[model samples]
Target chain A: MNEHTPTPTEALPGAGNGLPSYLEQSPAVRERFAQLQQRKVILEVRDLQKRYKSLQGETEALRNINFQVHRREFVCVIGPSGCGKSTLIRILAGLEKHTAGDVLLDGQPVTGPGRDRGMVFQGYSLFPWLTVKRNVMFGPLMNGHSRDSAEREARLWLDMVNLGKFADAYPHQLSGGMRQRVAIARALVNEPRILLMDEPFGALDAQTRAKMQRHLLKIWRNLDITVLFITHDLDEAIYLADRILVLKANPGEVQEVIEVPVPRPRSPEQFSTPEFRATKARLEALIHPPEAQGEEEAEGEDALPEKIIRFTNVGDNVE
Target chain B: MNIRILLTYLSRPSRYRGAVFTLGAFLLPVLLWCAVSYVPFIWHPMVKVENPGGVDYFTPGMLVDRSEFQDQMKEMRQAGKPLPVGVRANPIYLPAPHEVARALYTAFTTAPEQRDAPWLHQSLWHSIQVIFWGFVLSSVVGVPLGVLCGTYVTLSRLSEPFVEFFRYLPAPAFGALAVAVLGIYDGPKIAIIFIGTFFQQVLVIANTTRKLDTTILEAARTLGTRGWRLITHVVVPGILPDLYRDQRILLGWAWTYLIVAELIGTSSGITWFITQQARYQHFENVYAAIIIIGVIGFGSDLLFERIGRRLFPWDRTQERKSA
Candidate 1:
């Protein structure tokens, strides 16, 4: 895994100028590479593990997970249910504690929650008691920003989300999609370096999900900020991410990391493209490996199994 | 005549139908009382015999007071008119509506001979003081403890059983103990109201706090909020609208114990005044005191409902719950 073998599509242009390789670039482009490398690493996860201790027994949620998200890159981690995808995002957000391994942001180990990272949840957890403006300003106020400045910052983000007219509306008064937009503005108002989203669009209708995806992509390009998004939708990952991380469950582990060959500023029509279909097929195959079928055939034959590990969640194992 | 004219004006749907209904409902009980008190008995002629044997009182099938009959006869003789037929008209059990209204007016207007008397205002003020102090104490003690119990599972498990057990034991049962410990003064009265409302407040507030969604708290944490800030910003505000509702209900419960509290120690509250009047068979005064109590309770409830709505404009459930 540490062979440093670059995947075939790793050379795709990311973020700024889409000029070709260093060997082909002029001296000025080569000189710019040094400066790019200076802030290359934004998040580093090494040997990450999480365990839950219950009266019944110990449950290993995630094991030996390792990844690095580079500066200003959009990365998506896609997995089946109970693959510890939520847990990994929570740890990155510093909302949950990991049992072992290290997670660092800008070379500093994450201790607990800090304002450096913003998080968006699938539930769209906006404070129900506050208006849209107040919800957006909550973080800045907590950080001791003056009321006027916080209000100004809140208005700017609300305008960015196209919800400027709803600054005085309570969360319950808004629809689910609109509420999630407010939540996004609330998190972004703090100006965090990285944004962590856990299935942010999973609860939205398909049309709304597509709209939000486009909106997020537009914002991502405009702000040039790093994003670590978690989801179970393969097409969504392919459409939105520069790189996709596939995870397998039952003591969840990283199965593979695939680079999306499609270029940025993605559109909804790209879902039908051959490149998108190819990447999605590869993920589906990895999720449901061929060996799983062989095991099923052996069970039908009533043959002696090589190992016996009875899991209560047999359906989960099959998935 | 004016009331009849006003009623006719209000009875029209285009006019004040609500006013007509309120006035009609208010008069219904008084009309029933008057009919029951005055309509059953009829007047009967009393034949005065010349037998000279104690002027044999010949009253037939009528409840007649002997001295009242003689007084009527004497008044007729002095007027130079023939003695009208003696008849019984009034019953003593239920007072007329006018009599009760007159009693109420006198109670409000006349200064009692006793010093520092508990008239309408004084009696109401006394009860208010006790209820106010008791409710304040209960809120101060119950809210924080309830928040702690709700926030921490260990504290909830440790305290909930005891709270539930004591809440069922009856707050009034502590009346005697309260008098013994705090003496027969304002202390016992306040203690009774506190005991009546405190346990329930704690349990209700804890349940409200516990019902707070964990997702919102996680959202707050990711924003770099922690410690007391988390409690003040997220937990308290999250449960506040619901907690305000709970307090309203608890306040009503507090009112229930006030009469019992006032009865135990000193005769100082409106309930005491009513009970004292009942002992003397002043039914009109007793009824007046009761009406006063009802009006005040209703007025206070309306005020609380208005304030709750204003404080939590963001809470749809609070608005619906109050309505």
Candidate 2:
């Protein structure tokens, strides 16, 4: 699985043209990458497996899932639908039990949901009854922080998410993107060692989703926390992740881990770069194989059982 | 308010218009009752005797059937005696609107003819206590049980089937047993109300609890919340608004059973006042007592609605639609 081309370290066409080259990392970024490689591993999963049983029979949802996230690393897991990405993130958050595996955070075995790991789901999970400030304060207060301290912490995180002005607003009053931002603030206020996000911006519109991506990247860069993000969008994975963990469907297992060739301080301008396109193409191929593509095309044809039965011929002359 | 706006289908009008419509709701019914009572040609089936001249059985202020009054007047006329005089009026049971309105004020001040009987206010107070205790007790026991049933599938499976079955049986069916066990006093009356509301309350509250978004619970768990704190902080507050609504509806249900419940005991509440006035043929007082019960029930519902708005300011779904 590691047979993919080595990380592109050589200079490309735009190197001497007074334009940033896609195949090269800046000296400072290279130095940071070197430091990050040496940083202690914050989370580790080994030979993880999950099985769901019903009266029909037992089915494997995930198998042999092995990965490690270094401290302060931004790792995105990209896979097709039904690839158990949500299940994997839930297990890491300790909200779900794996059939067999060891999940460790800071070298401590994760037994159940604890303050060490914070989670943000794809859906709007903010408590509707709580104001933005109180929603952020929930984690701290539950872990025994005094109300004053919790409120102080909540205010800081809310301000970080650019939602300090809406601290008193209820969840229903906010837009989808704003709600997700508050959710992120709520998760971060716990000061968790790692953050697990399962398609947190999937429900937003294209424009809002893009904005939230940049917002999250900024937050991740400033904070000293590791992130394991799950998404199906290749562009999103390439845009946000330092490394992308691509998984193959039917009982999901890791296919490869690609080091994002694009450099740090990622911007929307970099989306057209050769490196970003290359990585996205690779993910697309891994998720939708050539052999499966043929079968899917045939199935698509079969799905439309009957020809169109148009009663109106008004557009026939135009066509 | 314009009639066009008021008549618009499925459209909420302005607040002033809404108030006007509510007043109209009360006035429409009262106007129909007044038309039937005061209009001389509008089926006044009886005659109220003003001067009972030459009629052996007719007494002043007595209401006699119109047909019977006519036959007596004809007999008097044929005998050349001064004809009996009367005016069109509704039957004794259907008191005129003015008489009932007067009784509304006079019923409270009038002493009970029987020295041992309680006054109208005392009867009303006693009935209110029965309703309060019965409903409060039901909520205290049922709310927690319902929340538990909704939270855990095992508990729900164990209890909901029986609750569903029991709620179907009329609450008054337990009157005899309650009287035997709790004695012929407020205890039995309260028990009947409890029986009426408890089973229904558990089912309603359980359904409300189930409607609480599961994603919020999952989010709470991820935030290091565990065990009973999940219930107290997350589940309870999450369903409080819906639960409050369920209680309001259940309180109304409790009131529906009050008359039956009061009848089960020694008859010491507003029901007693109604029955006593009815026996004495003071129909105006009976109507007054019934209307007072309606006012109390509707007024309390309105008060609860106002309090609920204040308690859960964040819940805007219950807010009245704007124009």
Highest lDDT scorer: 2
Question: Model 1, range A1-319, lDDT digits (tens) per residue?
Answer: 3413445454332312333321233355345444444658999999999999978799999999998888987889999787999999999999889999999999899988888899999996999999999999999999999999999999999999999989988897788899989989988989898999999999999999989999999999899689999999888898898778888888888887766665545898878655666566667766756568577557745567678877677566654
Q: Considering the two chains of model 2, state its CAPRI-style docking category.
A: acceptable
List the RMSD of every prediction in angstroms.
11.3, 5.5
Considering only chain A, what is the TM-score of each predicted structure?
0.81, 0.89
Off by over 4 Å in 1: A1-39, A288-319, B1-116, B154-165, B319-323
lDDT of 2 by residue, A74-101 (tens): 9999998888899899999888899998
Using alpha carbons, what is the TM-score of model 2? 0.88
Enumerate the chain B TM-scores of all models: 0.73, 0.91
Quantify all predictions' global Cα lDDT against the true fold: 0.80, 0.88
Backbone clashes in model 2, listed as residue pairs: none
Q: Worst lDDT window (10 residues) for model 1 chain A?
A: A14-23
